[model samples]
Structures are given as C-alpha cells and as structure tokens.
Target: MTATVAIDSYFTPVPDEIEAIDLVVEGALPPELNGRYLRNGPNPKPGAPPAHPFVEPGMVHGVRLKDGAALWYRNRWVRTSLFTESATRVRPDGSLDLAACHANTHVIEHAGRTFALVESGLPYELSLDLDTVGPCDFQGRLTTAMTAHPKADPVTGDLHFFGYGVRPPFLTYHRLSASGELVQSVPVEVPGPTMMHDFAITEDYLVWMDLPVVFERTELGVPYRWSDSYGARLGLMPRKGGPVRWFEIEPCYVFHVGNARQDAAGRVVLDAVRYDRATFRNEWDLAAGKEKTGSVPGQMLHRWTLDPRTGVRSEQQLDDWSLEFPTLNENLVGLQNRFLYLVGGGSVVKFDTVNGERGVHRLPDGAKPGEAVFVPAENARAEDDGWLLTIVSNRIAGTADLLVLDATDVAARPVATVHLPRWVPSGFHGSWVPESVVR
Candidate 1:
C-alpha cells in the first residue's frame, strides 16, 4: 500500500477564507509601508490534495497597510480554472490547457499589473484586493509554461523569464518589455526536460541551470530524482542574441537564487542555495510525504563566477548552515548587492557576502517563517536600508503575523507585527506590492 501524503503538519491547509479589518498591530508600523504584503502558497482543498505539497491549489494571503496602520487582512484562493472549475492542463484531444493551472507559487507585479504565478502554466492576474482576474498569455504569443521565478531588470524595466517542459525544445526564454508587451520568445537549447525552476540575470547576460532532475513516467508525477549520468551545467546566454555558452559545474539542485550580477571584470557572479544528491532526494521525499531516507545536510549557500572569454570559472560553498528563500533588494537584482536575506528553520538570516558575516533573528519556539522579502526604505541610504517583510506562522496558536524587520539589523526587534486572523500554511514565493507602484 502507498503511504499517504501528510497535510497536518506546518503546511496544513486552511479550510475556508475569511477577512478581518482593523487588525491589531504589536509594534509601530512605518508610515512609509503603504502597500500590501502578498504571499502565495499551496493550500489544497480539504479533501483534494495533490501528489506533492508544491502542486496543490494556490491560496494567497494579503495584509494591507496604510499610514502606519494595519487596515485589513484577507485570504483568497487564486481561483484558476483548476481550483474552481476542476480544469486540467491537457484536454481529451491532447491539446494543452495552460490556463488550467495552479497559480500557487508566487505573486509578483509588472507593468502595473499584479499576478499569481506557478511554473507549470501562465500567470493569473490579481487585483490589489487579492482577487484573481485571469490568466495572461501576452496576446496569444506565449506558447509554453512560465516559470514562477521571473527576473525583472532593474535598469531596463524589462522582465526576463523562461519556461521548461517534458517535450522537445525543453527550455524556452521569454521577455516582456517595460510596457508589458511580450517582445521576445527564443527557444533555448537543452538536452532534455528537467525541472528548471529558477534562473538569474545580469546587466548583459542570462543565467540557466540544467541539472539532473529529469521527467519520466512514475507513480508520483514530476518526480525530482537525481541522475549521475545526466550531469550538471550552467549556461550563459547573451541578451543581444547568441547561443547559450554552457559551463560544466558541480552536480546539485537549486530551487531558488539569491541574486546574480556582473563583476568589474565582466564575469557573471551568482549566489543561490544548493542541494546535493542525497539532500535533494531526502528533502524532496519529505515534501512529497514519502518515507524519509538517510540523514543529509539541508540546502546551503553557494556561489559561482563564470567568464565568457574562457570557459574557466570557480565554484565555492558560501556557508554550511541550512537556509532557503534567498532574497535581496529588487533594485540591485542584476547589479551589485552586498547583502542577502534568507529564511531558516526558525530564524531569519542576513548575509554580508563580501565579509562572510551573518546576522540572525531567531523566532520564538514553534514559529515557522516563510520567505523574507526585502522592501527598500523610503529614505534608503545603504544597500541594506530596507524592511524585510515575511509571514511567520505559529501552528500551536493557529495564527500568523506579518513580521517586518529592519534589513540592516536582523538582530534588532521587529519594526512592526501585524496580527493575522488565521494560521497561514507554508507557501512557496510572494511579492510585496507597494500601492504606489500599482496605480
């Protein structure tokens, strides 16, 4: 008999959606934080769970802040064709239904539009109030699935993203202009289909990871198993148009990237969390509610510097401590960013990449923190001058909080704590939608 996937742990799905106004604030909220802290995660319906925790229907939790006050908090399902109408991505005739997706991974904004995203299909737009509008295909131009981890160029205002699948032309790169027009969609050449979740970008180049996690027929769909023979490599493609320059690197799996930038020497440097063979399989099994295996280390901070002139490069393990959900200041996405913020088991860490210093904020017992999103301060003076916005959930209390901490000093007390009405399940990725950027 097959073991059942557990949903009663920290990731238990909330049964219903509710709203609360005039939320109580524990600490002083900065008047400048006039926006919504929106997060999306998998929240499978009560009787309807997916094969894994990551593929369930998506539910978005949002907290609205205005003028130093917590105005309201609301939770809404993304209401995709899958969530509401029980739609499937493939039709009876084998046609693909990209709109029938679970937009349950991340929520981001571009070209004045907010969207809920999952890597398997098109994005579903959401209103400021957290209501799903619909799927966006850039005027029928996007023929493939969109990865949840799209990078928006800080200087160019252009969006860089890619999509991968089980079919040939396994990887495709797409770009959207500053005004939201789908400008370019190029077929990136990869050997076969892999779980290409995330990528990075610098001022002049795009970063791609072609790891060993391949797709095949299995009891659990889209199994993330490691393959020694497939090998691992990172690719660098010119934004102007050129074939991807592949660099053979260490074998590992990366679910997220902290940031990537170009050094003064014109080489591309990238920071991200890495998982080895054992660790990736172990973690993947635990997430799928399968039986856990041998003890292995969790994800670690790793870096890679690649040069175009010569295919030579250096790889380094930045840290041994386990961490995930790496984030940095959006303005420095593909530029010089010295500070990186991440979430650990029960604490948040701020890593100074240049000096190898780490500042941590340990939460109270039984508190699980989600991704830490960096929002630049109104009077920002330094690279770390911002507020780290994250959702902390306490399962014992059946509640959660929108915790805001100063980015420069993670050890310092929270800048504000907006009390949420109910407990929020551990979700994937989200965005802090500042109201000023919307209208």
Candidate 2:
C-alpha cells in the first residue's frame, strides 16, 4: 500500500472558462488606472494532476480596467501541445518538444507581444485579449527553454533573460533589442546544472545564481534535489557576452531577486529572499504535497554586497519575517530602488530598504494575498507613487478579490476591491501591461 499525497490548498482548479462584465467594486478605482492585470499559474486537468505542482498546465486570469471601472474579467487556460495532445510524444532527437510547454509560471509583454512562460519550456504567445497564440521561437532563434522571469531594461527597453536546463550547456544567456529582435545568445559556463529560476541585472553586469540545487534521478515525481557536494556561487558577466567572473557565496537558495544595482564604488548590491539548504528542501517537499518532515524554514529578506575589487561578499538579513513574491517598480530594475513590495504571512508588505522601516497591510482572517504588482500613477512623481494590485483569496467566502492599495500607504484601507468570480489558485509570477503598450 502507498501513502497518499494530499493536494495543496492552492492546487484547486476552476472547472471552466469564465467571464464577468462590469464587476462590482467595493471602493473607487484609480482614475488613472488604465490597463490589464494578468496573473498566470498552474491549473492541472480535472482527473490528471501532474507529478509536481510546478509542471502542471497553466491558466491565466486577467482583469481589464479603464475609465476608473472594472471593464471585464476573463480566465483562459494556455493552449499548448502538452494540453492538446492525447499522448506524450518526443522528437526524433529525444529532446522534449518546446511547444509542449506548460506556460504556467508567468505572463509578460515585450516587443508588442504577450507571452506565457514556464522556465522548463518555450514561451507560448498570447494576444492582448488573453487568447493563446501558440508557441513562439522568436523567429526560430530561441532553441532553449525561456525563463519565466525576464527583465526589461527601463532605459534601453531591451529584455535580458537566460535559460537553464538539466543537460550540458546547462546555462544560456539571451538578449532582445528594444525592437524585439533576438540579437544575442551566449553559452554561459557553469560547474553543473542547477535550478536557476531567476537572475538580476545591473547597469554594468548580469548577476547569476548558481546554487546547490542540482538535478538527480529519483523514483519520486520531481527529480531535482539539494546536493551537499554542489557548491553555491554568483557569476558576474558583461552585457556584451564575455568571460564570467564567479564569486563564491554561502550555500543557499534564492528563488527571486527583488532588485540589483551597482553602487558608486562599483560594488554589486543584490536584494532577494534567501532560504537555507534545510529550509529549501522542506519547503520544496511541502509544495509538492509530500508528507511533512522537519519544520520548514522561513524565507528571509536578505541582501548581498559583492566587492569585485576585493573578491569578497558580505551578506545580511534585512528582515526576520517570512516573505516571498517580491516586486519593485519596473522602472527601477537595474537601478536604485527605495521600496520593495512582497506578499506572504497573510499580508502585503512594503519594505523601505534605506530606512529599515516596514509597513504591512493585513488581510482578513483566514484570507491570503498573492503577489503584489505595482502600477505607477499617471505623471508619477516618486517611485512609490502607484497602486499595488493583487488577488486576495477569501477562504471563508469561497471567493477572491482584486485588491488595490496605495503603494505609498499599504497599511491604509484598500482604495478599491474588485470582486472575482472564483477562487484563484496560488501560482507564481505575473505582470502589469499598461494600456499604452496594449494599443
């Protein structure tokens, strides 16, 4: 007999596509809020769940706002070869079909195109209306899996991203011109295959995390595990593609990076959520719905300052509480940023890194908030001048709400709460595409 693995609370999937028009708003919507708020996450088939939650099929939930009204809401499952085919098939070369991607991790817009992304496969293109446009190979130039988290430079409008695989040539870097052309792809040298989910970019260099979580054969569903033999380090590579300078750091895992910038002294500063080896394994098991083993460690807000001249790295914990899904002003990517927004521990928090002050907006009892996305106000003066948008799951009510809070005052009452029709399962990352980009 086999023990049962319980499905995570967030694994529940909606039965069918849904559209709601003229949703009722609890408060006033920002008059300048004109755009779409889209989030992507896993939604497995009704009877056939994937071996791991991360590999499940993707569903995108979106809301359109214009003229200070909730114009519409729609949810659609991304159509890919994986979801359409009756049987799993492999190419003649034995490589998995990139078209058969889950595309469940994130939805982003670049080069006038919207893409649904899963780090292990190619990105599926989608129209502004939230309709799947099928797999895209960037004009047949992208041959590797695309990272779900791609950073668009605020100044140059270029997109900087990378892909990591379980095979050799394990890491590759890609860059797209502001005009949306795949202009560069360079193979990055690393010791072994590690789970490189997210990376950061500074004005002068790219920051890569080569952690200890390596691929291993296993009888269980997810084959990747933390290895004591594999060491942890960070790589600094130039934008023009050259030899990478590696810096050794303490063994830990970083799933997301808040932001990175180069200080006046040319030192690289990175802020992220860091988890120790023990905490990472336990959290991964819990997310896979495996039985509880040891206690899970909290994801701490940490900062690393790397001095290239001295070849030394200094790390510090900025906050003691558990948090994840960190976001900052998109315009501040690769630049100095004052506030970092994150969701977890039943609240939306705003951390002032310079002042060491934190503000939290607590949700209703038994309710949880997803990632908080920042939308800058029209004619924005300050970095924090915007509204924070997120889906709040009301477990007690069996529904969800699109809560909008003032970015500068997160602890204040929500400026608006647009009711959602169903419970949204907890998923990964998402993006806010302004109407200017849509048209």
Candidate with top lDDT is: 1
TM-score of 2: 0.96
Q: Once superposed on the true structure, which residue ranges of model 1 sit more than 4 Å away at CA?
A: 1-8
- Pairs of residues at least 3 apart in sequence or in different chains that clash in candidate 1: none
Candidate 1 Cα deviation (angstroms), residue 46: 1.4
By TM-score, who's the top model here?
1
Error of 2 at 187 (Å): 0.4
Please provide, for model 2 over 280-376, each residue's C-alpha lDDT reduced to its tens digit, 9 standing for 90 to 100: 9878887777787856769899999988778788999999889999999999999999899999868999999998798999998757898999998
- Clashes per candidate, residues 3 or more apart or on different chains: 0, 0
Error of 2 at 268 (Å): 0.2
lDDT score of residue 309 within candidate 1: 80
Evaluate all candidate structures by whole-model CA lDDT and list the values in order. 0.89, 0.87
Candidates' RMSD to native: 3.6, 3.8
- What TM-score does candidate 1 get on C-alpha atoms? 0.96
